[model samples]
Target: MAEHKIYTMSVAKVYPHYVTKAEKKGRTKAEVDEIIRWLTGYSQEGLEAQLEEQKDFETFFAEAPRLNPSRSLIKGVICGVRVEDIEEPIMQEIRYLDKLIDELAKGKAMEKILRK
Candidate 1:
């Protein structure tokens, strides 16, 4: 019987910002490629070491920052999430909605509540 060895591959994805930023700074395509290679290699090595040390699958697959300038912002949801960038009124509105939901769930309020 022959023993088999399995190895997991690590993939590093670079954001579009790297290329755009490099071009805007007047770096040639070849230079940009080299930079990308160096960054990806360093990131991969660091991540692999972290994974080995932590031995946690979720931590190993953590999201890395995108290199592109025009990339969309990352977003996530949580049960009691608060965002600092939004206006106070918006936050208050969310709080009110949450309260309304709780009230309805507990059979406390059946009337429609309108927010101005």
Candidate 2:
């Protein structure tokens, strides 16, 4: 009897939203996996160090140029105004902007008037 050798794919399952979005964009499962791996590579360690050194998000954004104006990664643009931008700093900006809008809306509610 001969022993059989099998090669299983090493890609891990990511968020369903990612899979769905990737599929909707016409990307294959393999391509999506490769993109994920490439986006989060060994450079994560270096990014962590820099993130620690510059605790402020804006400061970090300023220092990390590659992740600032833009970085054309397999996933998307790493920053700037590009449609594919997926940088954390840009996400944070969006979040804060939403919160500001919510706060402004809360302050503009009309008060009920009492009838005599």
Candidate 3:
């Protein structure tokens, strides 16, 4: 089967949208960054490096220092698909991030969004 197009897309390409979504909803970029760090285990500096490098989603995820084990706790529909039901691991990871961002945009408390 052909690889999903999203796998090759740069995470940098989408990061701004996530930030904007949150910002429009009265959330801050730091909150978006925190959610990303919590899910991908990338430090603020490391996350910035990945963004600067324009790494594709596959590479971004592949090189993550430690994908949060608690990411599995993220479950919900994003763009019409339930994240937990996604069969592709990379896709699931992508959706997990999307779900978290969605929650942040929806004004969920940071503690709950981080699953703490």
Candidate 4:
């Protein structure tokens, strides 16, 4: 059987796209920053450094100071796959971010989106 490799996507590439999606729905860069920091435990400075470095998603998540425990509570379908049902831990974490972005774009309150 031929082995297949998963192509890792770049967080730096998608980060601005996410911000644009959120801003179009009346969100702000600050709010997107808040979400990223809340989930990844990165300070504003650290987050900015990562963005400036243009890191890949794997590296970005790998370097996160800490992943929020409450992130597991995030439940929903993204791209036809349920976030909670994702088998790969890393992929699940990525989907959690996607779900949060979806909520932010849909105008869910920041408090709720942050799972506070």
Candidate 5:
């Protein structure tokens, strides 16, 4: 059997990278944060607190205040794996965020991006 490694990367470490990628494509960090809020239901303050504390992705999602139910409607292949094909709920949530970031970077409008 293949060995499975643990996930320990902090969201704070990755957040700036996401911001930079989106900014390179003309998207703003606020826009990225907005989509993150939409997915995780973290208030701006709550999200910032998580970043300030250097929370891991596992804890970030596990501790999300509210996960938007509409996020499940997002379906597509990301990184060669179908978003809907992910069997784990937390993994699904993470992929949902990734998909939203991709859409944001692609210039999709906030309303449509939020699936509103």
Candidate 6:
């Protein structure tokens, strides 16, 4: 199968949507950044660098310093598919981020959304 277009799309292109989704629901960009940091283990500076470099989702994930193991615990339907049911590793990771953003928009507690 051809690689999903999202794999090639720059994370920088999609990142603003994540921030807007959270902000529209009254959450701060900091919260979205926190979730990304929690999921990918990128320090604030490192995260900024990733954004600055406009890395594609594939490379963004591939270069993640330490993808949180607890990400497997993130279970829910996102875009009509359960995140845990995604067979492709990269797609699953992408959906994991999407699901976290959705939770934040829905007003889930930060700790719970972080799976603490």
Point to the candidate with the largest lDDT. 6
**By lDDT, is 2 or 4 better?**
4
lDDT string for model 4 (1-116, tens) is 33212216667788898899999999998999999999999999999998888877777888999999999889999989999998876777788898999899999999999888
**What is the per-residue lDDT of model 6 for residues 65-103, given as tens digits with 9 covering 90 to 100?**
999999999998999999999999999999999999999
| Per-candidate alpha-carbon RMSD to the true structure | 20.0, 20.3, 0.6, 2.2, 1.9, 0.5
Q: Which has the higher TM-score value, candidate number 1 or candidate number 6?
A: 6
TM-score of each: 0.22, 0.27, 0.98, 0.92, 0.92, 0.99
lDDT: which is higher, 1 or 3? 3
Model 4 spans > 4 angstroms off: 1-7
Q: Ten residues in a row with the worst lDDT in model 2?
A: 3-12
Query: Which regions of candidate 2 deviate over 4 angstroms?
Result: 1-14, 42-116
User: Candidate 5, 34: how far from true, in Å?
Assistant: 0.4
Pitting candidate 4 against candidate 6, the one with the higher lDDT is 6
55: Cα error in model 1, Å: 37
State the local distance difference test value for candidate 1: 0.33
TM-score leaderboard ranking: 6, 3, 5, 4, 2, 1
What C-alpha lDDT do the candidate models reach, one value each? 0.33, 0.33, 0.94, 0.87, 0.86, 0.97
- Two-way TM-score contest, 1 vs 3, winner: 3
Best by TM-score: 6
Kindly list the per-residue Cα lDDT of model 3 for residues 1-116, writing each as its tens digit.
89999999999999999999999999999999999998888999999999999999999999999999988888889999989999999999999999999999998999999889
Where's the lowest-lDDT run of ten residues in candidate 5?
1-10
In candidate 6 the C-alpha lDDT for residue 24 amounts to: 97
For candidate 4, what is the TM-score?
A: 0.92
Return model 2's CA RMSD, one decimal: 20.3
Alpha carbon lDDT at 29, candidate 4: 85
What TM-score should be assigned to candidate 1?
A: 0.22
